[model samples]
Target: MECTCDYILKTQPDWEEHYENCKVKWIAREKRDYPKNNDGTLRLRNKHLLKLDYDVLYHLGLDTKTHDLQAMFGDVKFVCMGGTKYRMKETAKHMANILDIQCDFKNIVKQGHRYALYKVGPVLCLSHGMGVPSMTIALEEILKLLHYAKAKDPIILRLGTSGGIGVTPGAVVISSSALNDTLEMCYKLAILGEEKKFPCNFDKRLNQELLSVADSEDFETHLGVTLCANDFYRGEARTDGAFCDYTEADKQTYLQKLLQLGVKNMEMEATAFAHFTSAAGVRAADVCVTLLDRLLGDQVTPEKEVLTEWQKRPAKIVGNYILKYYNK
Candidate 1:
């Protein structure tokens, strides 16, 4: 009989073997005391998940049966997501330095095809690709992963770039709430041949914490509503697509209407991102730096260096918030 210490699964063959080997241990945890909040609560919506002997996070190439979820991810307190793999990897390293924690953190996903994920101490930085569908897929797996890991009260942050409405480029905007293209604060999803609506509310206190951090900095930051579009062109009222029926004047009018409704910026993924987190009883926030003022232009034409620095602003503020929360 092999000891449990030598049973870590790493390959396809070993993964299957380890699954069979860990049945006893996995089943044993069910009888033991599960971690919970002070009030004995679990944030995950799937309340009956503990009945399962094992679970696999396919896209992430990790399994609760093979890997020690409690040992691997129990310490995770923050999960930051962005649009690109490169940006997220950078954010992970940047966070490591900010927290003064040294880690030669490598991409944990063996196949880097789906999404890039890095774990630095208590933070899990992930690239969610783009748009609602992409974010939704990742969120589904991530929620299960956190649930299996028994992570306590983890706060998720979507740190990305967006086109500004009335604000200047390079300014940061912390989302007050996420609104869909219909100007409704609900995430509509087709489930079992029916359209279901989920409220897309964000954390007000998290917004204020990010805002307080912003106030201490020299750069500009605003707390306002974010319009989450399904597409970058027509869905966001842009005239620079491959085909556009609307004229530039029409685009201006649409943008003006959004501005009048208090929308500060436009992005592609906040609808599902905000709704799913809220549905799971976890606090989520979207902090985006304006890449370009849509009222001024349609294209993001900032210099490379300027764009890089602008992209890092939200991550810095988020890191500061995490540091402050831990220090206090």
Candidate 2:
């Protein structure tokens, strides 16, 4: 019978695999009351293991770039934003069929969304959606995957559904800036003050890339401000009568104030994305398809199809824009 070391060697032929195997071995050795180095390379129990320096894990798959691209746009990466878990899975399978990409619908996870990595040209398109949490999680996963793949300054373009603030429904808005008002939570936590702000900057190159795509597609794209709030209903104050502690007159006044501020749409995750990724120095921006007209008193109920045919107009524009940018 082969020893664990030999077993790992037989199974993994790459550096990443070797590294992972050695890491596990180091941990196991430590649990056996053996001494180890701070970096987990040298071992007091057996200096022989030290010679196994080649990282099998790193080579176990492809290079970091290849892995990233595979994860980003492999046969299983494009995902839908905002819907029931079952619905998201069904939608993902359907999209894969439409895009002629391989898909796995059984991997549905948190908030009920499915993910697929699509291989398009030389770039990989990492996409997922179907509700705020799922969408946010999908973005987080993509970032982590990119980081693991050691991608250098990869661009992120979010194509999701959003509520029109002052703009007309069905309009496609290319978000030049995503303003996060949810940072108020940090203030509430007493970690900072209400005036303290943390905003993420979008990548200028990628933004221009998207704009060029929009122009080529002939879609009406607007570069406007988008507000990211924690709560959808209360954040936008869309609740029926008594939306907030304010009166009807106050609510109307607030709407007018927001419009004056030039907020074109409202969503839940963009701000968080900006705050987290900006801190990490990633170039990211959001492009959303306006599904509901918030100012027109149109509520985005669950009964609405996750992605209506009309919504496809904006999605197509955004998708093509992303494809063109990455292709370049």
Candidate 3:
């Protein structure tokens, strides 16, 4: 069967070779007959050797019987946020309940790979948790859904938690630009390296709205560079010398360098979202609540209570901004 993965693998020499080498290992896993579902049904299975076309899978959502992706969100506006399941689920539920809209969680591809789509008014709130890979997948899926639904004048918002880079803990950082450190690595790894530079641009109007809301709420919001790191724990250092595994001096030096680059916060997904949305000419912005002051050697864990409180301030600011902007 023709699949998007196949096309990508065949066209990219390095990827083709990598896939060829990995094919045997994939074959050892249990094979499930795909196309097993009727022409329109969406099936979920974990088979390694299935030839699934991403484009085909994406389009399947348009076929209502096959996948109810559209039905998932009615006429409500959509917003996207990021966090662990606990944090996201609770926050999404709160938003949905408050907004009086239906919100549902869908698994994007793997464990810890999930997104909550909440619709209220003319906005749709979509959020996910995981690192860069999951964020990329969610963005792709969201784009496909928006395209299939013929959604126009749609504005995408990213609400999530991040570590304070040069800023103080508890200070909210609204990303004006996401500096993609991983894109350079990915391009360099390519056999035929492309000279394309990912443009760092965001929706100007949306940014203004965020700033206005922040100002009105008297919240400290910084508009600067945000680094999207692939390895969160490894990339971020901890003051506690625990899971992050970085020495205090090392962490300070790294933070200083990042701050020199104008990075105010560090997170896992915004870079890719910014890159993709900018390329697609979509309106997108990310508002991240600072959970830890990495520059000051504060450790951030996925503690429920801490995250709950951390999310409330940013969510309130972003949520109010969205309501005011869209409502006006």
Candidate 4:
């Protein structure tokens, strides 16, 4: 099953014509390359990609051969993603100030018109939109972009807002692990009409490092499991949805059980987010600030000013970590 073309191509000058039609497989299916660059950066496992002359990162409006990914993002160390364009832009600005970068920041992904990407010194702060589906689209392209860029051991963080369990509003949560709404500690993914499960988790030492950074900051940080719900309402046991059969008492009971199980917050993307980055051999973490406490209520009833300030907590903690990394 191995390729016969290697010797032919090396030994013959006229092998180009037969190379395209060469029946020999050049890559081994059982043994994969270490999945890391010599400098310890991430590498993708898809073998067909080796033959492609070029790779188009359509969503990011960049490509392998067309754009100089290594030059543009070679220094990138942190890839921070969130739920909205404004938040990521704000994060870019904040990160820039932290890294002492002085310049006009533009959306690097504006051409794609799907996601907002801003390069803040060594940080790639971008918006992943809402839920797993949107995040997945952005994640794939960005991972490929980084792979091409040859960024070393990129720390991918999903910084966003979530609903807390027993914690108060404005509290920040560092996800120790991700769980589905059904309380499964796995990301249920559908592949070719078949459903499969992958362990839903994040980097443990990174979580501790973030927590260590949080201790130096003035924010309430809790480390616990995050319930990645599928919907904004029914999937999260919210009674205020357009349609809901569950009563308020039932919702409260379920939330209490989640609280007892050490779930500190509820979000929509961590399950698959952790899986994607972990599978790519990258260290990742999810840090979110609570908009409201689900144990107390359902709706995010905080004032806009308060919620806006609360939204920035995760960034503040993550920023400190970035600074620590830089200083170290």
Choose the strongest candidate by lDDT.
4
Q: Over the stretch 1-328, how does candidate 2's per-residue lDDT look in tens digits?
A: 1122211112222223222123344354333432222322212233453466331222123233333433443332222333233333444444544445574443412222245444333234444444345555656555544444444434454655678777766777766566655423221112455345554445434455556557765446677777766676666666564455655576567666666777787776666565544444344567777777676674665345544654555446545644443344
Highest TM-score scorer: 4
lDDT of 4 by residue, 86-154 (tens): 999999999989889974779998999899999988999899999999999999888888888889768
Where model 2 places Cα greater than 4 Å from the true spot, the runs are 1-138, 182-197, 216-219, 241-244, 301-307, 325-328
- Of the two candidates 2 and 3, the one with more favorable TM-score, higher being better, is 3
Give the per-residue Cα lDDT of candidate 1 at 170.
Answer: 96
Off by over 4 Å in 3: 1-65, 68-77, 97-114, 182-197, 237-247, 301-306
Ranking by TM-score: 4, 1, 3, 2
lDDT of each: 0.80, 0.49, 0.57, 0.83
Tens-place lDDT per residue, model 1, 1-328, is 3323122112332123332113233245334332234432334556566677877788888887788887888888889999898999889989998888888768886563688889999899999889988888887888888876888667788999999999989999999888898999989999999999987877655566567767777789999999999989888888888878888898888889999999999999888888777656566789999999999889889899999999999998888888777676
Q: Candidate 4: misplaced stretches above 4 Å?
A: 1-33
Q: Least accurate stretch of 10 residues (summed lDDT) in model 3?
A: 1-10
How much lDDT does candidate 1 score?
A: 0.80
Q: Which stretches of candidate 1 lie over 4 Å from their true place?
A: 1-44, 47-53
lDDT of 1 at 61: 82
lDDT of 3 by residue, 270-297 (tens): 7677766644435568888888777665
